[model samples]
Target: MRKLFSIIGLFVSCLLAAQEEEWRVIPSVREWLEEINNWPDSVYRQDNLHVFFDYEKDTGLIATTFEETDSLPSEPLFIVNKPVRVSGLNFAGDRKGPGTMPRRLTSIQFNGWLTISRMAQNRAGFVGCVFKDDMSMWDIQSRNVLQFVDCDFEKSLHLYGPQENMGFYIANTSIKEDLIITSGNTDAGIRILNSDLSQFFVNGKFTQFRMDSTNVRYGMRLSNVTISNSFQLQNTSLPALELIGTDFPELHTYIPFHNIENALALDLPIGWDRDQDLVKYKAESKEEIMDTQRFDNLIASYYTLLEVYKSRGELTSYNACYIEMRDKVTARSKLLYNQDPSFTNFFAYQINRFTRAFSDYGTRPEKAIIVFFQVVLAFSIFYFFFPSSWNTTNNRTMMRRLSYLGSYFTSKEGLSDLFEKEAKEDYKDYEEFHQFISSSEKRLPIYFQWLSKPLYRVSVSRFNLSRRLLASGDILKGEWDQLPKAKQVRTSILIGLYLVIYLIYVLIIRCLNAITLSLNAFSTLGFGEIPTRGLARYVTIIQGFVGWFLLSIFLVSLIGQILN
Candidate 1:
């Protein structure tokens, strides 16, 4: 069964990778403009195209150049006619859905290059239009010299350039492939983004570029561009890149912009990135570390004592009575009282039962036995899977990598040291350092915490083991009387098995806690609660259980075969 799942997982991953399309390649500025001039506007889907370009008519559209004068206010010379249809694609400038009519729409094909220059006003120039939908793949590649001049995209948009260098301005246009800008003249450049006006996107590649300041919400690149005299400026919004041709070693001064507000090409300090407009993340530091530790310890200790009492049959009557009362009452809370209160939250009361039971189970040998069996099952599985910690850690690392950072500690001792230091540092510095470390480490705070968790958990296991051994009359007799070798060997094996099972159970419970916390953390990252917690979390838990179960079976089978 586990092998079947492994195969299915691999197949699905392969399918997704195969389905993703490659981004288009944009053309140089000069080539792009000329291609636009040759565009078959004659292929207009409606009369709207002519209305925007016909100078003879006093229509709100139609302008000679990129200048907003008394006759022409908007720049970037050419504007696409609304409600244009291309290659079986429908584009409407006016987003009309019942009462909601959008401002305007622009359309471009990604098959050639486009270029724009000599504006009527605004020395920088501009070329853009409100788009109801994304620009198609054919509009992005037909130009070489493309410039925003001075334009803003309104709505969620996409750029699809040509498969090859066709040369054309793909502004207010979507490129199918890479967003390449090969321009010699200094001017405002292309800003391909969503019509919603939230971000700037260069789906594939970025080659040979210059900029004063830009907020590429996702990321940016500049390949084969000379940057000594032409400085690339970056605002505090997005990441910037200086792409030196792979062949030119000297040009590969790939210095990431340290200043969030300034990506100007220059030597800056290491701490400059700290000043950027990153969402002020202030993690509420816990002031009472020992107190928190004591609380957890006390709860765990109480649960362990209860387990011992149950094992000895001392609490059998009390347990029975409590169970009876619980079944009669709120199903778990036989003893519930509130100071100066008459009523309690029914839902909270129910939840508390499971929470307490879960807590109690976590501290018992039964939990370890369950977890050990699970690990054995996982080891039995026919297909390969990562270690349990791998999934959570990998997810965290990926997010951190996207944010451009690395981890400071990847080990239990290292993590413990980090927390100790963090607990003592200034609040602001600690938070920044935490974010930075998480980003750098490519792991979440939860994962780092897990790495150190085993150290503390081992203490519980060891203490319990000692107590269990001391309580067992026969085990103590074996040790004291120097009993037969076979008996001692059997006893040792039992003890080892006991230890394994208990460890597995504890680990699984810890994993569950991590699931809950990580879900809450993801909400802060703008992901929907449904995606982060519902289906995804359940799937993860199921996978973990199945993998562990299969591995255990496999290991047991292998051992049996060897013994036979």
Candidate 2:
């Protein structure tokens, strides 16, 4: 008898443990109320209908609210001590009879497979809940706050047509699939904090919207969203953001470049019919008429973003937005050209394209310089191959002309023939003195030989023959011809060496002259006479015109940067 009693006690204990592991389903509102009412006063508070579940017991409760028949007890709080799965919990605040007090559900821990439908005229808050299936809330209308905290939704969460709420707050939540909110209007604001979401879409009108420390793995789209107050985003990672017909009074974002994977789509057509097959219709068709308002809105949006980034000192984002804006403008101009087919429209489109390629719409001045050098180098190579296209005047003549121009501008003496003659005489005397010092070594006294030796060395170093030979082809050829014939055969090897060096020197000089000519044409400096003839002269004129245009743009950009 003692052994049987012990066995019975053990069996009872094991059955209780099995029951604790399974969910206790409250079949109706009557049963749910009775179970909570019988709870000890220490665990249940009457004023707020707050019930604290026993944590030590590890009870898993399942509650059901039938929208068609049973109604939830008024203003009930359901707090779970352990993981609980609540199914078919429906709140129909709108369906309540007149003078019926609205139900307020607070501190509800929905552990699994929750679906809320027709929730209205009441407040609801959920915390630390893990939803196992797709959860959706439709037609939610609450005067008090609707809040979700520390929740994880394993599947998609959708909220539809939530209207006139005090505020909607979601924090520290994770959604595995898309979290979509559509047509939501709020009085206070909507705040999402420290949430990890997949695809997120919000199309609503709100007093304000704030998101912080949230990461969206997929793309986010805000279509037709209007915010009367500020929209703030801080420390949010948005891989792809699309803004279509979205308007806000102010945008405050502290997102880094890496957080934004794609460029913001500010230029998306606003007024076009999104439901139609736009790709099938030709742009020139009447149905595809450009909306001027849409274009202006896009420009205004870009300008606003640019100002915000500039104020925040985000130069990379500012430059990116500026480039995108310019491209949009160019696209608009192209559309106008397609519609009108007029010279003005065509020219505008072409010029925008040219500027975009040449300097990235003037945001990068270095791009302009790079393109300028590329043009100069290309022309230089062309001129190098076709020597006859350009004139190779005497190097001495070019130098003399340059010297004359410099003297004309800087000389204390006026630009007169007497001034020129004095300059020539001075030059001639200096040349003669240099020759005497360099060649005539016996003219110096023994006492002054030290000074003479230094001066001679200086003169020889200053007037190196190799440099003169490189500077002028005529000088090199003359020196070679001046060699004595009988001695030339004796020094035939030396002659061959000189010829080889001269050929190399000529090639280098020719290349440098080609580059110089290209530079002169590109700068349009006209420091001396034009060195091209025939078609090349026309090409140089074209190059000069292009140079003037690009240089003007570069100067404007530089000045703007400095002023800013």
Candidate 3:
């Protein structure tokens, strides 16, 4: 009984196989020529004598042989009026007999819908074809070039597993849906020009891959692809591009973006905080850990793009890519820190953050300068309000004397001979000669008097106050101190004016010294003595260290820029 069942099953399988092969029977070149000749005038014309095949009625297959036929047109053209599906189309050169050479089809044109599950190939060219349905060509092996021109694919087009030495050329075509090519080794490479595509993807190894003057609307991804010679994109606009484990030997010089209108979108594979989330999810659900290979590939892609931009001298794009790369590195470090909580990972994460914040990973030296100035300005403001004892001069005695004179004037016994004697002693060394010498040494040129006159006058008047006060010796004598109230008041007013001027001068000098201190600490120049004491000394030391680090980074970045 079992033997009988087996025989019946074998018979059924053979019948099914035969039935499937019956529809795929393709007409010979001679038969196709006869069909073309028999078509009516309305269906065929002399100028375009291509054969039209209806999918519902006509067998949509054309098989070529090893024998050269004289009747075949130089450029054969076929039109499919409706959607057609074929299990396999053997357009490849087929051997007819021993020692017979394989025949080649140079060019062919298809006008309408056509679908093929598998294709065996020689040289095949497609022109002006419009595929209305999804087309899948699996494991295509072509001896020569496969070309497509001025074609439109309304649905997805999949080309899979092309063999060695097969060249694919596509120009002036539009693919409205996804176009996917996967797992091929083509030494002659693939060239796509002046085309618009949606969701294009390629995963293969090739000698070269180039896309010029093309626009990809949705997204394009190249995963596990290796191009040994070159990979180039010229005047191409890829709105979203994801590259995963792709190797391009000539990435530095070949990817040009001179004419692209939109900014290239480098879509990263994983989020910055993806690892943190993964950690949490694993703790709760105990699912498999996420592989960090994607992150590694993401970093490599960023580096490749960075080199491309740098080689092209696109500074803005280069810096942007550099910053992005550093950000990814920092994030990866953070993930490692989260995983192990080690000091090394923590330090690395923090260091990356610092570099990104200060210099954009050392790609922009100007950023370091800007941050340096910000630090100096901040410290300057702090030192301005709370000046250290070393940078500030002790003016308490001068202030006290000013206070004493004001009080003496307010008191009924206005002033005393003792006070007058002390004042004389203090002003005795003041010289008119020294005043002129100092003013001359510090004076601005006469031509700049228009801009500096006000400041110059203020300085000169402040310096000469001592000489003017002692111009008459009687001003500070005993009789003068015992003068009437009106006279005493006049003398007090003159002294008050001098006190105000001197105080203003001292404050101005103090402000300048504070700025000097700040600059010295921030730049670590140390041109002169650092007189800071106590806490201010420590603060200055810290600023010096920071300055050293930041300046070193600035120099490195600047040198890199120059070298680049």
| Maximum-lDDT candidate | 3
Candidate 2, 448-541: lDDT as tens digits = 7667667656755554443354344321222333457765454455535755775567677778878887888899897465666677677778
Model 3 over residues 408-491: C-alpha lDDT tens digits?
Answer: 555542344334545554444344534554577557576554555565566556545644545443243434456788887887
In model 2, the number of clashes is 0
Error of 3 at 438 (Å): 23
Residue 273's lDDT in candidate 3: 32
- Model 3 error, position 493 (Å): 14
Off by over 4 Å in 3: 1-113, 116-128, 137-150, 160-167, 182-185, 205-207, 235-245, 256-290, 303-318, 338-342, 388-508, 525-530, 556-564
- Writing each residue's lDDT as its tens digit, candidate 1 over 420-511 gives 34333444454565556556564556777666446545644554455455444334232312547787577567655755775566556545
Better of 1 and 3 by TM-score: 3
Q: Determine which window of 10 residues in candidate 2 has minimal summed lDDT.
A: 60-69
Give each prediction's root-mean-square deviation over alpha carbons.
35.3, 17.3, 13.2
Candidate rank order under TM-score: 3, 2, 1
Native-structure RMSD, model 2: 17.3
As a TM-score, model 3 comes out at 0.58
TM-score of each: 0.24, 0.55, 0.58
